[model samples]
Target: MKLDRTDRDIVAALQGGLPLVAAPYAQVAAELGMDEAALIDRLKAMKARGIIRRIAAAPNHYRLGMVANGMTVWDVDDAQVAELGALVGALPFVTHCYERPRALPDWPYNLFAMVHGSNRDEVEEKRARIADLLGGACRAHDILYSTRILKKTGLRLRRKG
Candidate 1:
């Protein structure tokens, strides 16, 4: 959708995050010199046009007492990868699960699942549960533990004319 000046302003304002106030839209509206109702309408329009997916807080699992995190890579049957991926993603412990092209000459695993827990044993138990769920479909796998966190952030907005 073609965005107007107001839409552009709203997007730019929300790129960081909505204010932690009772009336965040009103705050944004005040900053942009637009009414709260108009701002809400513009945001709804943006959602309808698929410009914005959803607005939510990206939580830090490690900070929230989740100390163990493992990126589990699996070599599963290509035909059932999507179905199994959906199943794996549905698990509460599995935060992220997706299929990617395996890096040739080095990596042979195409399916990846991320499991989090308070300790290594807990994370391993989750991995074992996932193995049981996949049955014999998964050929080989590995759990890559995180050594350090780099960076994390939400969406970035492009300036519009």
Candidate 2:
């Protein structure tokens, strides 16, 4: 779908993300000189057309003091992987959980979860809870910690008029 000036303008304006305030969308619309309703309509249309995905915030976990985190990889039984994955995802300690394609004989972990805590012991306790929940469905699991802080950046676009 070809985007007209208004569409392009909206995308460009929000590319940096909405302002942080009680009324973020309203504030953004005001800054972009767009009517709030028009901005909402344009965003809805863009989402419907698959031009934009959901908008979310990436919190600074380190600043929040959530320093202890591990990527917990689980080798779940194929027959019950999805069910067990949902349970793992619902855990309070799990910030993110999803199923990944197993690499087969060498690397057999199929479920990945981001577990966070204030320290290693807390992380391990959560891991134990996960294991208890998985029960027989969980074959084996491992936790991998980040050696350094991760840097995240938004996608960029280069365009010419």
Off by over 4 Å in 2: 1-5, 159-161
The lDDT values for all models are 0.87, 0.84
Question: Candidate 2: what lDDT?
Answer: 0.84
- TM value for model 2: 0.86
Any idea what lDDT model 1 has? 0.87
Q: TM-score each candidate.
A: 0.80, 0.86
Model 2 lDDT at residue 36? 89
lDDT, candidate 1, 1-161, per-residue tens: 67777778888999888899999999999999989999999889899899888787866778999888899999888888899999999998888899999787689888999988899999999999989888788988899998766656666778855
In model 2, state the lDDT of residue 81: 92
lDDT of 2 by residue, 89-137 (tens): 9998798999999997999999999988778898889989998999988
> Weakest 10 consecutive residues, lDDT, candidate 1?
147-156
